[model samples]
Target: MPVLLLALIVFLSDQISKLLVRQWLQPNQSVPVLNNIFHLTYINNPGAAFGIFAYQTPLFIILTLAVIGIIIIAYKQFPIHNRLNLKLALALQLGGALGNLLDRIRFGYVVDFLDFRVWPVFNLADVAIVLGVGLIIWELWRKEEKGEAQ
Candidate 1:
């Protein structure tokens, strides 16, 4: 129940932010929030990260679906005890995947707007996905270190 709630929050946030950006900015338009440091730059990404494999909508859709399925299966298989972080990570990944997948299905591309001027433009879903992966790695490393100490 908690996982579903968290995922729903992420999905809603991602979609709302994208919708706002779409309404406020035109494609390739950018509004700097910080001097040359950060901006809201709208972009329609038709491919994976960094816009690689552009126009490969079908492939990305399939891959996202596969990832969503794997996350669901993995989350269910995780033991109920002491697996809060793992479960949270999976929930985040699931939400982010669904958010982007919906965009891909609706428009042949995913909507991105947040820009740091150092990395490619991305959206809330991407942030959630990256944070989720980071949390998973941190949790696994902590467990490994604890095992070694014991």
Candidate 2:
């Protein structure tokens, strides 16, 4: 249930924000929300993060599918007795990946809007992916400190 909720929230948030950005901002239009720090800049990414693999749609599609499969298999390995964080992290990744994957399939690109000057421009799906990774790392560190890693 928690996993499902996490996935749903991420999917809904990502899609809604992308839709809003598409409606309000034209391609290459940027509106600063914070002085030199944060902005909303419309961009369509035809490839993976940092714009890698541009024009490699087929390769990205295949890789996304493979990642989805791996996430599922990895999630299944999570201990049933563990905290909900692991499930939530996996769910977040599942939702974010699917969100971008859907765009790649439908538009041949991923809609990205959120922009931070210090970091790469990203969207809600990117947030989910980063947060999910952070949670997983935190869990690993916690387990290691407790000598409970197995």
Candidate 3:
């Protein structure tokens, strides 16, 4: 389906960007794209986003695998009608999860860059996952509103 294709695109792009970042930048190297406001700083995150739970590599890896499995089943179970947003959200989450999972398996950590001074440095996978979650939340809110109106 198109959502699956979208997932492929997100996954490939995330992996490719990580590959380039790892090759071009040394660990903890910062190249300012916007003079500290933004930069490409390479960091190998051994934990979840924002560096939380910084020592649970095995648990994170297992949880990621479970999320991937759940998404696959949810995607297939959903009927193809007017649920494009839901589908896309699931696809994105799947892709992002897989991207990070790949890094965790290969390097025992995830490659993160795209530094914004206000927040912790993150990468494309993080972005995709956040956007997907936002979309999912919006869909749920919409459904709740519809039910309320009914």
What lDDT does the true structure give each of the candidates? 0.92, 0.87, 0.89
> If scored against the real structure, what TM-score would every candidate get?
0.96, 0.94, 0.93
The sequence of per-residue lDDT tens digits that candidate 2 reaches over residues 28-127 is 8999999798999999998789998887888888988998898888877757446767787788898998899888988899999989988767889888
Give the C-alpha lDDT of model 2. Answer: 0.87
Leading candidate by lDDT:
1
Model 1 lDDT tens row, 76-96: 775635678887898899889
Model 1 misplacement above 4 A: 148-150
lDDT for 18 in candidate 1 is 95
State in Å the error of residue 144, model 2: 0.8
Compute the lDDT of residue 33 as modeled in candidate 1. Answer: 97
List CA RMSD, all candidates. 1.8, 1.2, 1.8
**lDDT score, candidate 3, position 55:** 69
TM-score of 3: 0.93
Mark the regions of model 2 whose C-alpha exceeds 4 Å error after superposition.
none
Q: Give the candidate number with the greatest TM-score.
A: 1
